[model samples]
Target: MAGHTHRQLAVLRAAAAGHVEMTCSREPHLYVDGLACCDPTLGHQLAGLLAPEPAAPRGPGLRVPAVLTAAGQAALAPSAAA
Candidate 1:
């Protein structure tokens, strides 16, 4: 997963918790719908992370969005000071 993707997912997931709506393009690009704001490079990074790994290869090119897993979220919550 790309580092940018991880950051984007982190941002999105954080927003989601606050009931902020988001949208993912057909290409799986994420967007902050109403806000009409997003960092292009960050979006690409996030998309790369979210992409599935190739069936035969391993390593880079494996888009695995570093979306916060439930456990990760729980861990982050306290630090978020929310």
Candidate 2:
């Protein structure tokens, strides 16, 4: 399983339910419906992390699945209750 930051964990929890995005609230926060997407910077970071690494060559990117794969579910499990 991937080691996720607290922010990443929060994002995964929210996103697990559906697509995640920033809100148009006065604070300009991130959210998905009733849930708030915590840590705007990390939210964007996690979004980048979730994207499949660019086509393989000699590069320094962690290979992540295009979608929330089984590994991702495992990563989120430990933090879901919080």
Candidate 3:
């Protein structure tokens, strides 16, 4: 969690729970708990934690299906154990 802040961890946890969504755009955006995250770099920060699903016919800026990666799951483990 060195590189991840509280908000970042929350986003990861939400993603792990399938409560997060992202858009496929030049600058991808992340939405947590059905609400948009104001941070523009949120997608980049969580890139390592996200595994994109198969390519879909989504228009620019449309929602892109994604799943949490092993790293993402691990990221939330410490908190869960606490």
Rank candidates by lDDT, best first. 3, 2, 1
Question: Could you give the candidate ranking by TM-score, starting with the highest?
Answer: 3, 2, 1
Candidate 1 colliding pairs, count: 6
lDDT of each: 0.40, 0.48, 0.76
Give the per-residue lDDT of model 2 (tens digit) for 35-75: 55445565345543343323423233322223344656666
> Number of the top candidate by TM-score?
3
Predicted candidate 1 versus true structure: per-residue lDDT over 1-82, tens digit per residue: 2222455546556543542322333333333433533654544444333322224233433323224345435434545444
* TM-score to true structure, per model: 0.31, 0.38, 0.73
State each model's C-alpha RMSD to the native.
9.2, 9.8, 2.9
Worst 10 residues of 1 by lDDT: 48-57
Q: How far off is residue 50 in model 1, in Å?
A: 5.2
Candidate 3's displacement at residue 77, Å, is 2.7
Clashes of each: 6, 0, 0
Question: Candidate 3 clash total?
Answer: 0
